[model samples]
Target: MRRVWTSYAFRRILQSVFVIWLVSTITFLLMHFMPGDPIEIMAGRLNSAGMSHDQALATAANIVNYDPDASVWAQYLDFLKGLVTLDMGNSLTSPSKTVFDHVMEYLPWTLFAVGAGIVLATVIGLSIGMAAAYRRGSAFDHAMTSIGSFLTGVPNYILIAAVVVIGYTVLGILPFLDMRGRVTAGVEPGFDPVFFGDALYHAILPIIAFAFTATGSFLLNMKAATTEVLTEDYVTVARARGLKPGRISRSYVGRNAMLPVIPQVALQMGTLVGGSIVIEQILDYPGVGQMLMSAISDRDYPVVQAAVIILATSVVIASLIVDLVLVKIDPRIKTEGQDA
Candidate 1:
């Protein structure tokens, strides 16, 4: 058992490294192969500021450490050097700012908005799903399944739009819900009550929009897993032993059923980092996903590459954690790994 665990741990570390490498390599190659030149995009901005096209192009190339005359191999080597030094280069559109700065500024917002949403969804979904499963084949169970399925089919952005229309435009009840930026414009920046309260207020709509979309899938997954767990022999034994219904539901069924949801929660958190792009855009919330979309549009290679790498690394690490957790939850996972 010890040997199997050690092997699994080592294998997971290597797999995580490979996943990051593969994702970074693919992003780099695909971006480089794309038709638009980041240099040109930069130069276009320069031209708008009155510089001649040829001169603007030359200046932009020098600023970004790119040489159109250089071989692709040489450019790739430079990129690797930048990566090693943690200098992800500069944004083409925003020449004065580095990709690292952009990420630091925006990544936290994504974490706040999407992270809160996923956590809420997991908690709510697990509770409701377990409850629904306890009354399997009842009207409540069927209704929940049907509603979850319907909501799961709708895209998150559409929900965001509908929420904006209904909450702000139609109802006007949430007057403090600012749809643009991370906080109210005049709020002092700090951990003070005013700032934090405003920040939370601003985040409410985006978080709700994201959570509403995320909950449905989690609900369905948890419902299925819980239903399966309730049918297991241990649950039957608990019932036969004259355990109280509530006690059996909580200790025997809920405890065992939650095992599957734990690893899934980790995986979902990873994907949430990338999946919140549309929600951010709609809400005008400043986040890494919003930054990434702008970078792609402006052909900001450094920002785009850095964002992709960060997201990929996040996913890989989360997946590794999930694997370790699964082994801890179910020892048979180690045996399965060994067999594979």
Candidate 2:
């Protein structure tokens, strides 16, 4: 068990490194392709009388801690140096804040909203799917499948649009979705019910929106996986051995059936964490995804890079987690001698 865990941990580290590399390179290149200079964007509010194109270019170069005329290799080395030291550079729009600082400011919003939403959705969907599958041909099973299939067909953003519009435009009951603003309008006091209550109150809409969009996917995936598991030969043999209904359902059916869903669960968790930018935007929740959008809008290269790197790291780590989970749940997956 120890050896297997060690092997999995090593692989996770390797994948994490690869994702970090990919994210850094892609972020750097994408920043290069952006329409304007980080320097101009950073200094715009302060320097209303902006610099010339040349000056703006120079300012951008300075803020990014790079010599504009330096060789690509030199810039690459500097970039790597920054990466190693965790120096994510500066945000052009919010010149006072480093990229890391920017993300730090907003990450918790997403953790509470989309992160929790995904977990909630997964738990609910997976449990219900298992139930539906086990009760196949029953009215409840048919109802769940029919409803889930209908919901799963719609794009998440469309759902987001419909729901947000209804709430904001027609009902006017909830605060409109806007990702950039904090619940307390800026202050986050520690361990106070007033502060926590305001935060939760604001979080209510975004959480529901995210849950609605995510639950369908979870349900569909779980149901499909469960169906496939039920058809497996072991399930057949479990019944042949005269296993009790509940025991066979749990030990043989649900456990083995959940193997495929495990990998997807990890990946979806990563996506929920990283891909909630749209939800955050609509709802005004301050998360990493919202930070990415802000960085892009403001041409904050460092902030954008930092956010992407965080997301990419999550994906790689999730994949590794999925691998380990599969091995843990089913010892037969590992090569001989891997299991004690």
Writing each residue's lDDT as its tens digit, candidate 2 over 1-340 gives 6665557556556667887797788777776667765555654544565666666666666666656567767877888888789776766666566767778787777767766676777788788888888788899988988877766676555676787788778998646644335576665767988888777777776676666656777677778888888898988998998989899878887787677777766666675665588777766677777778877776667787778777777667767777867778876765432443
TM values, all candidates: 0.88, 0.82
Regions more than 4 Å wrong, model 2: 1-8, 33-35, 40-62, 167-181, 185-187, 192-194, 231-233, 236-244, 336-340
| lDDT over C-alpha atoms for residue 282 of model 2 | 67
- Assess the local accuracy of residue 234 in candidate 2 as a C-alpha lDDT between 0 and 100: 85
Task: Give the candidate number with the greatest TM-score.
Answer: 1
The list of candidate 1 runs beyond 4 A from truth reads 1-6, 47-59, 242-247
- In order, the Cα lDDT scores of the candidates are 0.81, 0.72
- Candidate 1 overall Cα lDDT vs. reference? 0.81
